[model samples]
Target: MSYTLGVDIGTFETKGVLVDASGAIIAQATRSHKMLVPQPGWAEHCAETDWWGDFVYVTKALLCDSQVNSEEIAAVACSAIGPCMLPVNAAGKPLMNGVLYGVDTRAAAQITELTERIGADLIMARCGNALTSQSVGPKILWLKQQRPEIYALTAKVLSATPYLTWKLTGDYVIDHYTAANFSPLYDVNKLAWTDDLAADILPLDRLPRLAWSTEIAGHVTAQAAQETGLAVGTPVTVGTIDAAAEAVSVGVKDPGEMMMMYGSTIFMIQLTALPVRDARMWYAPWLYPGQHASMAGLATSGTLTHWFRDQFARELGEGAFGVLAREAADSPKGAKGLLCLPYFSGERTPIHDPQAVGAFFGLNLTHSRGDLFRAVLEGIASGTAHVMEVCRALGTEPVRVLAVGGGTKNAVWMQATSDIGAVPQIVAENTIGASYGDAFLAAVAVGRVLPDEISVWNPVARVVQPVAEAVYARQYPLWKRLYSQSRDVAHELGGGA
Candidate 1:
């Protein structure tokens, strides 16, 4: 049987999957990587090692584990943590470590500078987004101004997926969904690149050509085939950001259906019938043409749990998150009245505050590690609910929320999100997320499958229903107040640092 290969580079891992024509996974493999924090507000990944290196390792592993012939693979696709900023040389080598997504807030100054120079209204009108940590335009400007040495040698700017596509197919292409994150550089109405907002960011020619997620960009080269164990000249599609692909994996294509990705950060994307033009949330064309998507996310989610485990549950050793989940589950609904702000990487969406600091309010000597951990989960849940509130205010409440990612395995976190957000979540039968979606997109690109067939490919496994709780009802408000009341102090501390 023919097969499609899919790979995705994540914040902390890379996963690859080989699937048959019927959407059954033949084999899957994964590789771990570290996210570099060179400074307090920056996040980076070495493109050669973490991005492309993990990809080659995962793809070869998938092929070897499945014992699948390279010629049997019909097509390949890739997705990754994006809307990132990576300047590359003429040969498509990364000039520096790849700047990560919204979690990295080093461009706060550039964001402010561009927002003021080019009026916020104009940017919102043309780009369909407000300048925030997620916007790649500011980061590009930061590179141009702060690292001119690298910028001068830069031949093109690319995100994670295109970087992979280039390495595989020698094509510089980006899907529009990923391109939209380059604010002031991408014009939403025209679905094309633009330097009208701020020409000084970089020349438009330095960007990758735009294509749809399901469009074939180019064929895999002989060199790439040798490294990846795929047949030479295999079709590769122009890929998208990890979250959008994850959304597609769970059949979240209809308007009002949302995908809440519980990954390193809790990212949410809601398909909308029309552009929900607001600066509080981001808007972008969907993977397909003429479609729209609205996005919101918290600055940190699973990463916070990682930090907590490293600091508080070191004794548990491996599977610390699982052990921490049990401890958190034992804590009361509101974590014994403790409230937390999951702004360790600064806040995003609804409240676009970069200086926002993480805090655990109502902490007392009586609190246990369980209470603190529970507070952390609840804080992330509260942040999620805040985003849902914004979507509702914009009259776009999701018909259903499809939950995906490794964090979904954390029962306490998933239940807390639904309970605090007062929203039911639908978990798909296959939780492989972006890589699975990439395979499906690859099949679609080659006309092997239709988009709507995703339902038949992977049906719903179970649903997480929101349980009403008086504790959450009372504590969520305080959670909001905890951030607002301490905003000044948080900024002061952030500044002093």
Candidate 2:
């Protein structure tokens, strides 16, 4: 039986999956890694260790567990957290650790500088996105200015998936979906790189060739085959960011279909017939040509829950997350009047404030751990609601919201998200997420399956209906106010250091 291999490198983990022609997963494996925070407002990952190392380990493990012949693998595909900034030398060795996505706020100054210098209105018109922490253009400028020696030696600037593809195929390329995040450098209208905006950031040659997500990048090299335990001639498709792949995994194909990824961060992607430009949200080319996507993200979501587990629930050990979920379930709908802002890494979408801070307001001595945890979940839900509000305001509202990723397992978080957002979320059966999606994309690339067959591959498992809770309606506004009220103090604290 023909099979496909898929791998995804995420913020805190890497996952791999092997699936047969029938779309049944034969084997799956995962490896965990740390997100390095060198300083406040900075997040990074070691490309050599966390990315390539995980890829090798997971691929080998999946092959061993599945007992699939290496020659039977038709194709390989990958997706990962992006658009990250990782400069590499001539031999494709990482010059430094990869700068992470919207969570990393180290380039805030560069964002502002570029916005003023290039004209914000022009940037929005040309790039279809405003300068924010999510943009990779400013990060490129940051490296050039802050670390010129490294910049001088840089051969190519790549994101997570592109880096993996380069390792696998020895081809420097990026999918358009991931390339759109390199704002000011990519012209959304032209659907190509713009030399005018990129002139100051770096030479256009430093960028990789652009392709669609399902297009084959190149065959795996002999060296890559040796490292990955795959055939040298195995085809590797041009890969995309994890969120886009996750959207594809759950059948978010036609316009008005959306996917809300509840991973380390909360990312929302809604397919659109045409580019929908809004300063509040991002616009990008979808995985396929002639398609558009409206996107939004929160700086933190599941990451906040992880922090709570590590800091307060150490005794729970392996059961920390499950226990925390139960504790949060016990807490009342509105967390007993406590409110939180999940801006731990600064706010994204709508506000676009990199200096924004996280806070638990209305906290009293009477509150318990359950209340705090519940507040955290509700806070993230409120943020999701805000994104939905913006999407609706911009005329890109989704007819169906498909939920995926690790956070969907948390009943409290999922329920709160649906309740506070006032949107019913459909959970798919195979929400193993981006890695699974990558496998499907690989199959499609090699003509093993059609794009429309995703429904047969993984159907809707269940739906999380929005609860008509008056408390949530009342508290969401306060959640919005918490950030506004605390903005000045938060900025002071952020800058004081």
Candidate 3:
């Protein structure tokens, strides 16, 4: 039987899957890795070890576990945590660690300089995005200004997915969905790379060739075949960021359909007929040629929960998250008047404030661990609600919200998001996310399935309905004011990073 192979490199882990032509999973595997915080406000990953090494390990594990023949795999695809900036030399060796997405705020100064120099209106008009920490152009400029020695040797700037595609197929290419994150460098109107606004960042020639997410980039090289245990001529498709793939996995195809990814961060992608031009949201051409997408996300979500567990629940051991979820479930809706700002890794979307600080206001000595855990989950839900408010103001409320990811397993967290955001969420049968989507895209690349067939591949299992809660209605406004009133203090402490 024919099969397709898929792999995705995430912030904290890499996962792979082998699926038969009928969309049945043959086997799956995962490898964990760390997000290197070399300093505060900076997030990085070793391209050679963390990105590619985890990929190789996961791919082999899937193949071995499934006992699938190398030649039976029809195509291969990958997705990764992206718009990452990783510079490679002439021979494709990484120059340094890859700078992560919006979570990394090291390029804050460059973002400001470029916004003032190019003007925000022009940038929004051309790129459909404002100068935020998510923009790769500013990070590129930061590298040139702060580490010229490495910049001088840079032959090409690649993101996580492109780096994997290059290793597999020996081609430097990027999907338009992922390329849109390189703001000022990518023109949304033109649907191509442009050096018009930021010529000083890097030469246009250094960027990878652009393609749609499902397009075949190239065939696997013999070297890659040797390492991956795949057929030498296996086709590899140009993949996209993990969020986009995760959206596909859950059947977010229609214009009004939205995918709410509850992963390391709470990322939301809504397919729109036309580009939404708000500076608070992100816009990109969808996986296909003619589709469009508007995106928003919190800078921290499950990551904050992890931090809480590591610091507060060290005694709970490896199953701490499940244990914490139970504790949170025991707490009342509003966590006994406790309020939290989920800006542990700064803020993204709506506010775009890199210096935003996290806090737990209204905390009292009477509160228990259950209350604190519930407050943390509610804080993330509030951040998500803020993004939903932005969408409503723009008149693009989602017709349906498909929720997927590891966080979906936490009943308390899932209920909190639906309750706080006041949006019902549809959960698909398979919550494996991006890797599964990559496999499906690989099938599409080789004409084994159509895009709309995603519904058949993974049908809706259940729905999380929003229940009106008096406490959430009351606490959300105070949560909004808590940030506004504390901005100056947050900025004052920014220098510590």
What is the TM-score of each predicted model, taking all chains together?
Answer: 0.99, 0.99, 0.99
What candidate 2 gets wrong by more than 4 Å, as runs, is none
lDDT of 2 by residue, 1-497 (tens): 49998999999999999999888999999999999999989999999999999999999999999989999999999999999999999999999999999999999999989999999999999999998999999999999999999999999999999999999999999999999999999998888999686588989899999999999999999999999899989999998999998998998989999999999999999998888998999999998888999999999998998998999999999999988889999999999999998889998888999989888889789899999999999999999999999987887779999999999999999999998888999999999999999999999999999888998999999999998999987889888887888899999998887
Off by over 4 Å in 3: none
Write down the RMSD of candidate 1 (Cα, Å): 0.8
Task: TM-score for candidate 1, please give it.
Answer: 0.99
Model 1 lDDT tens row, 1-497: 39999999999999999999999999999999998999998999999999999999999999999999988899999999998999999989889999999999999999999999999999999999999999999999999889999999999999999999999999999999999999989999999999899999999999999999999999999999889888998999998999999999988979989999999999999999999899999999999988999999888888888899989888889978787888889998899999989999998898999999998889889899889999999999999999998888889999999999998898988999999999999999999999999999999999999988999888999999999999998889888888888999999999999
Off by over 4 Å in 1: none
Cα RMSDs, all models? 0.8, 0.8, 0.8
Backbone clashes for every candidate come to 0, 0, 0
In order, the Cα lDDT scores of the candidates are 0.93, 0.93, 0.94
Candidate 3 RMSD to the real structure = 0.8
- Pairs of colliding residues, candidate 3: none
Q: Comparing candidate 1 with candidate 3, which one achieves the higher lDDT?
A: 3
